[model samples]
Target: MTKTFKTLDDFLGTHFIYTYDNGWEYEWYAKNDHTVDYRIHGGMVAGRWVKDQEANIVMLTEGIYKVAWTEPTGTDVALDFLPNENKVNGTIFFPKWVQDHPEITVTFQNDHIDLMEASREKYATYPKLVVPEFAHITYTGDAGQNNEDVIAEAPYKGLPDDIRNGQYFDQNYHRINK
Candidate 1:
């Protein structure tokens, strides 16, 4: 079959998933030509946090195109979407700041004084200047089995009320009964 992808507009309001070969999977829902919501299926933010990012897309051929976006945390990710073959070429570019500053983490306070429970935004108590150095993380991946993915309605939409309330750390899985 001939692929006729000319621009991101071709897939507006569409949901797609990338099942990366590296054992990771992510869901992407294109809200429009410039915005997309992605959900991470694993790791610290898995099923807990989701972000809508401004995306930049480009077409390389009929069925192939690249979609790139800068996450709020400064991680740059680019994915070459091959819709017809259910394939994707993905690259996650990490700035040196991620490795150079390991101490930076989520601070409930020092950032959000208005919110009653926790800061809805990144705890900006301490900000760093990232150098131009970057590491290119490349991976070849397959598409999701289907496009009927569960979309995160909002940022951190999957967060539990207990965690969002900060009654305690969600460490039930880590703490052993002693």
Candidate 2:
């Protein structure tokens, strides 16, 4: 079963955290031919719109925006299936026909701030991939917080200094391999 969101406030109100060794990115699709791109940005919903790169699409239905942190914020966020142009405005951009059929699901993970389920439909023709239930996250948090910090902060800031010289995504990136 999937969770349904009636408003944007309900979406952003949900809380989950992302665990990434190198802070990866993802692409999402809905019943319509709409797509969204996201990147792991620390302390904020990290990612971009798949259709247009310049457009900084933040939230889906509500302010249920995506956020990444080195440590868990102890806040809960929601997830939902929405049909809107990936933009900063955070408004619904769908035709009258789409209102009848929505394919987004809202899920909460023990350690994740957010996760997405690509639409799996017959006519809309979207790709379906199994979103992992357990995710490994790396972020900088209070060392005294939990036992998980060992693994999270290690790889998160493990990239070696030499490899980090040219260009990188986040300040925590530490190239472990030479």
Those runs of model 1 whose alpha carbons end farther than 4 Å from true positions after fitting are 1-7, 43-45, 96-150, 153-178
Over the stretch 1-178, how does candidate 2's per-residue lDDT look in tens digits? 1344344333322212233323332222111112122223321233211221122224543533432211121212222323221211111232222222322221112222232212222223222211222233222111121122112211233232222242322333322332
lDDT of 2: 0.25
Pairs in clash, predicted candidate 1: none
Per-residue lDDT for 1-178 in model 1, tens only? Answer: 1334455555555455455654554556555567666655433234423334578866677766777886545556777776656666777654444434322312221232344122224343234333222222222112122222223332243323222243312232111211
Q: What is the C-alpha RMSD, rounded to one decimal, of candidate 1?
A: 11.8
lDDT of each: 0.46, 0.25
34, model 1: CA deviation in Å? 0.6
